[model samples]
Target chain A: MTDNTRRRFLKTLLAGGGLATLTGCDYLSEKTWFRDTLAQGETLSDVVQHAVTPRKAMAREYTPADISPSFRANGTTDPDAVEYRMLAANGFRDYRLKVGGMVENPMTLDLAAIRALPSRTQITRHDCVEGWSAIGQWTGARLSTLVEQARPHPDARYLVFHCADRYGRSHSPYYESIDMEDAHHPQTLLAYELNGEPLPIANGAPLRLRVERQLGYKMAKYVMAIEVVESFDHIAGGKGGFWEDRGYAWYAGI
Target chain B: MARARLRTVYRHPLPVRIGHWVNALCLFILLLSGLQIFNAHPHLYWGSASNFEAPWLSIDYHWSRDDGYSGRTQVYGWQADTTGVLGASPGRNGELEGRAFPSWLTIPGSRWLAMGRSWHFFFAWILVINASLFLIWALFAGHLRRLIPTLEDWRGFGQSVLDHLRLRHPTGEAATRYNILQKLAYLTVIFGLGGLIVLTGLCMSPRMDTVLEPVLEFFGGRQSARSIHFLAAGGLVLFVAIHLFEVIVSGPVNQLRSMITGFFRYRDEPATDSATTRETRHDG
Candidate 1:
């Protein structure tokens, strides 16, 4: 009796697998009902998150001793090509990071000038989409401080990062952008250090942007310039980040 | 070599076994990646947006310079003196990195998040189907009516409750097959894990927003789904831990062989008093 029942159960398990396995074709054509989290006391999700959540999210920091020895540089590490080499050879002495477009004050600041600006230090982990992580002490000027200095125009809704790295035959440069909320985030910084030392060449030497709130790709290593844009449509890829253009979600909070 | 013999004709069905291991793997990956996500904001809440990113909640960091920069070493610590939660990350160097599954694919990425999702969802169906099938099969096969307890179960159950409450075993029966305690716990897990995945998937899915909004409300919201998912995963982990302990105590080969072969190896030891068969010996 038990034997018969067990076999039946096994057969049923397999049979259930045949119940219309997802064809993946219906989603785009349908009315698409999955967007409203508000109807359900999603407000409750909000309330609880607010209660336990930190006012400012802090990455689990580590001492220099805890920093990884070999942090694999993902995406594009050094900005592409010979111009970056020339800059690297000269220690990026004359490199300029411009924060214009949609800003009241268009400023062109050299590496030294930007470094001279008030800075913030944070020891945070860099979360990569590739399934790895690393903790490093990053010291640099707060991105907010720079945003304040640049005084973005009232309509500026996003901050786009223009980079020198590109994959394949794309004529446009590798670029990424984030909303104003991430823009003013306290952890966000134009980082110049990994661990307690200067940013290594393979790790975006001379400068990089760290929007700690998002994934590592959002951090945009090998960043060449900061563009304060009113919208992201005009930029390369148009979807936001190098990966985002490829169908990755714009908001990778988790 | 010593003589070895096949114990029974029963074993875990292939689909059930596949589901079990796949769920295990998915849960492991989810936990690891989930930890990385949680590290972004350790504490979670019920809302769409959280302000833990605000400046006020930030713990201050200060370096107390020794006598001088070149002289005494500085003390590196949090200014307020709570656990700095100082740590690094896992998977920094491994076979898997950036292998994000494509959006259109069943899994989410080539190797990481997407695959975890795919495995998790696929195994979820396996678990649900197998569990349901087993329950129905048990009911139809007279196993539920006969093997499942009676008034005796309640009495045994009361004593069992007392035993567990007092952290002692009852005198009436040493649990065979399964005790009252096992039934309650396993049933609870079956429900909890199953419900959690469904609830979380509903909460996370951009597609289920309207249909399962009540569920989201019951838990809280989308973020609540995340919270529940995390909690549920943690609970399943606990279940796995305790399950391993029981498997160890029960004699791994004997119990496992029964599950695999679908027949308990008849054994004789000095354990019989009621229906458990006295003088049972495990020869697996």
Candidate 2:
């Protein structure tokens, strides 16, 4: 073939290949097998991260000066649920956080009861899955204190946080689950205050989780119940969290 | 009358050939999927948190009843209209969509951050493994040495630059080995930019931030690391453009064949005594 023809052929070939690849990716994304195959990367990341980092490694904390002036509240700002609105109307005075499931002691604690427990105040960055971050001070009772008091069963492996909000157009109840390791981490908290003030309704009023090491989605807001379970397979979408059920990685370490 | 001989040399080994193709594929998927992920936020910041008031770079769109759709890209303090590409682009349905990158540039060709992350992370693992293997092989096989420039190579750097600008590639024995410019560029892309991109990627991960706190500190913060990651990726794209341009200018068919089949063919001077002697010495 002439040099010009060869060059033309190569150009056409590259263009065809590129188009094919893009369409192929789109097609593969729709297939369950391809998505499952892709999920192996998430598994790998989780494993590698756990292997390299200390189990109790704390997320970086910032001072008051470093706190963002305006923290953008994402996901469910105001839960449309009637019960949530009623609780908000009463200033969450009668709000109760139920800790149950596979725990020996199923405890129901009110806001003051929860606040009476050992509390921690930390100023850490909240990283969203969309790639934005906000630094704010979070004050709440240590999740470990509650978990210890509840006395989880030996078989209990995950802590599922059932929230008051329903997310997106589907109106799916927002929920997230984390392993015992993260549940007991020093930074993990059932946060009730933001920037030293009561957590705003936009940010998640009454209470939210502060899983500092994970992305914001993993930190379920407006947490109404904490269920200790052996597995999250029977949960809402059966993938641990609302976003996870919608194709986000269950392990949000990355 | 003597005729010119077409001398062939085994330029690329099997491992190198495999690594090259794998790296190329990984880079393509990573870049497109990365763009898809970037579209979710469409802005970059510095330091720890995203200072919403001021961003290092941002892609934004404004739609008015009279003006229709207008896309704007702001870098530092400068702004430019980048419609049909950045800020607003043609979507899967061929309608204008407010997105950081065009649909054609994304993996799924739509706004799908979850699938995009899946693609990005999957290929990222492959890229890291492939790069690690290639680096080890290069180190032991003296391939790394060939990429590093010598004092002699540095002395000829100016000439090499001029030759490259003139599109004058080496011939005969010189074709078998990398030139000084090639060495430096390869070194930078392979070790400098490649390493930076991967490290910055890790820095973006909250979990990784805990493990690699020193690296996070070095980059100032996660947001800073993220900005640097995008810049490093841009640098890599630039390198690939120049690399492809060089390949095409020098000889695409020959270059492609060499990368694929490991054999490189170069035109030799007419079968003369002196030319034969010099070829033998260089090959040896």
Candidate 3:
């Protein structure tokens, strides 16, 4: 072939190959089997992270000076639930966090009672899955303290956070789950305060979770209940979280 | 009939050829999916946390009564209208969508961060594994030496640059070995930028951050690492562009065949054959 013909051929070949590959990717994304194959990467990441990282390794804590000037509250800022509105109107005085499910001692603790528990204050960076981070000082009851108080059954393998807020137009209640390893992590907290003040309504007021090592979506906001469960199979969409149900990875460590 | 003969010499090894193709595919998917992920929040910041008011780079859009939609891209206070491409692009319905990159340029060709992340991570693992195996093989097989510029290569660096600018590729036996510029480019892309991108990717992972705290610190912070990662990817894209251009200009079919079948053909000039040419004429 002539040089010009060869060059034209090469261009056509590259463009055709690129278009075909992209179309194929979009097609594959819709397939459940292909998605499952992709999910193997998430499973690999989870296992590798757990194996490499020490269980007790703390997420890097920053000083008060490092705190963000304004932390952007994403997802559901204000819960529209009637009970949540009433509790917020009264400064969460009537707010009670229910802790049950596969636990020996199922109990409900109000905000004051939760604050009275062994509290931990930390200035930690909250990394969102969308790729932004904000450092804020959080003070709340250590999640391990709550787990110990609840006295989870030996069979309990996960702690599911049931939040008061409903996300998106679907009005699906926001929920997240963490394995026992993350639930009992030192940095994990049922945070009620941000930057030394009461957590604002925009930032999941009353209470939110602080799973420091994971992405922000794993830290379920506006938490109302903590349920210890053997598995999250029966949970909403059976993916352990609102975002997970919508195709986000359940393991957000990466 | 008087016709010039061509000599064939093995160029790439089997493992190298496989790794090259796998790396190329992984890079293509990684770049497109990464753009999709970047579209979720088309803004980049410096330090750790995003300073919402002062982003280092941001792709955004403004809608006014007069103008239906004006897509704008800002870099360090400098702004430009990048409508229909960078800041905003036409969606599947041909309506302008407020997305950072165009659908054609992104994997899945839609606004889907979760699926994008899945594709990115999956291909990322493959890229890393393929690169690792290639590096180990290259080391044991002495292919690493060919990629590194020696004193002789350094002395010929100026001549090589001039030759490249003139599109004057080496002929005969000289074509069997990499020139100085080729060695430097390969070394930088394979080791420098490649290693940096992987390290920065690890820095972005919260769990990995705990283990690679020193690496994060070296890059300034997680956000900085992320910015560096984007820049490194751009570098790789640029390298691929030039690499392809060189392949086309030099001899597309011969270059491609050399990579695929591990054999390269150069015009056999028996009259010009010297002792030096004969010495370096062994198969790679």
Candidate 4:
């Protein structure tokens, strides 16, 4: 179908498609296990979303005119730790992002080394969970290329990002994770530049993640380390990320 | 005992009965949780991007020496103080809290945005799926016939509105089917507003932009889509409020019973008028 027709069809489907199948399905009432499976709807949503959308489907790119004049930095805009301060003082010259854990070949790459790798530049909108959006141009090395060089173990299912920012009373270092499927996605990047310049401290200088398809929180900033893991259950508070531990969904695709 | 009797008829089919209650419960969950989600930013813009400099709508709380407590709301830059009711209000514990849309109306009753999102998405999926099945079943089962407004209905639509405003209702045969106003309301809610809300919601999802490029264009951009989504949800809330009011005013017991049991006890005396016999013949 033409794009216009497809869009119209989707609109129609959204109005009249899934009602009785979800509401009047007697099988759910008849079976206890079936009823319990509703809790797994999160995982089901993830799987179904992945199944329908092509793996390489790129997020919409914006023109330079579309870029926001001032992209407001949110959450932990600045990390006050001595190590981060020292690195910032020296313009992140000594910053090293360690990629290890379940990888067959663990690697420690610094700013120059990461920049030397192949990179991609794209302008895209950042959608926050707080119902705001801002667009900025980002330049970064493809994460798939980095992971491939690191050579993850066959059992590695997730890539955990450990950052320098500490938050809340617990002073917990901020962290986030993504599955192997997303790790290898073409658009997933280890960004080091924003708006045609080296990323500012407020924008996670040195290194940050740009998981374009997910919400802003999923794009953890202030790079420090990466750990390949089979499961995220034992990391941080065991919910995958600091925010995830605090009730955010680990798979924050939206 | 040689007297008149009340007539009853099957008005709501089984799927319609199930879809109605499910949609109601899902809408309840979605609206509360959606408000909770909206409370996080509490600001809206027209275009794709928004910085503090340019917000079309905002709810804010401020303190000043002259005014110990104050709340302000700005829509399209028009400012108004809504202190005691909107921007700042008494919490459940009777202490003042600064927020738009009180905690009581929110899902978690606190500023837990993550939990609010969870509740919103969970019910959102249910609402979408339930509406979808209802639409398909409605088409095949001939349920759509009752909802789709006829040309005759269009001509009488104004009269129906006037009747409703005057609290005058039809009797016997005329009351059996939905009035023109009711038909129009159902058609708008089920097809127009319902579809718009869902599409706007999908537009807000960053990932769905690829699939919904045309929809996003139609809505202008993400922030505009968000604004439209919020407005559409409000429309649904208004529709429900008026619907419930009419139900109660018309006759709550029989109206609610029709939905719950698929049978409606006729509101007028039976076998006493030509209308009742004509309706019986139509049913046959």
Clashing pairs in 3: none
Model 4's chain A TM-score stands at: 0.83
In order, candidate lDDTs are: 0.56, 0.91, 0.90, 0.82
The best candidate by DockQ is 2
Please list all clashing residue pairs in model 2, or write none if there are none.
Answer: none
Cα lDDT tens digits, model 4, B58-153, are 887777766665678999858998987667777768766788877667766767687667667777888889999998998998989988788987
Rank by DockQ, highest first.
2, 3, 4, 1
- After superposing candidate 4, which stretches have Cα over 4 Å from the reference? A1-41, B1-5, B64-69, B267-284
DockQ score for model 4 = 0.26
What is the descending lDDT order? 2, 3, 4, 1
Candidate 3 structure quality by residue, lDDT tens digits, A1-254: 99799879878998999889999999999999999999888888888888999998889999989999988899998889998999999999999999999999999999889999999999988888999989999999999988998899999999999999888878899999999988888899999999999999999999999999999999888999999999999999999999999998999987
DockQ of each: 0.03, 0.88, 0.84, 0.26
Best by lDDT: 2
- At residue B192, what lDDT does model 2 achieve? 91
Runs in model 1 with CA error above 4 Å? A1-55, A168-172, B1-183, B186-284
RMSD of 1: 15.4
lDDT of 1 by residue, B114-164 (tens): 223323433444545556776676666654444445566666776566545
Model with the higher lDDT, candidate 1 or 4: 4
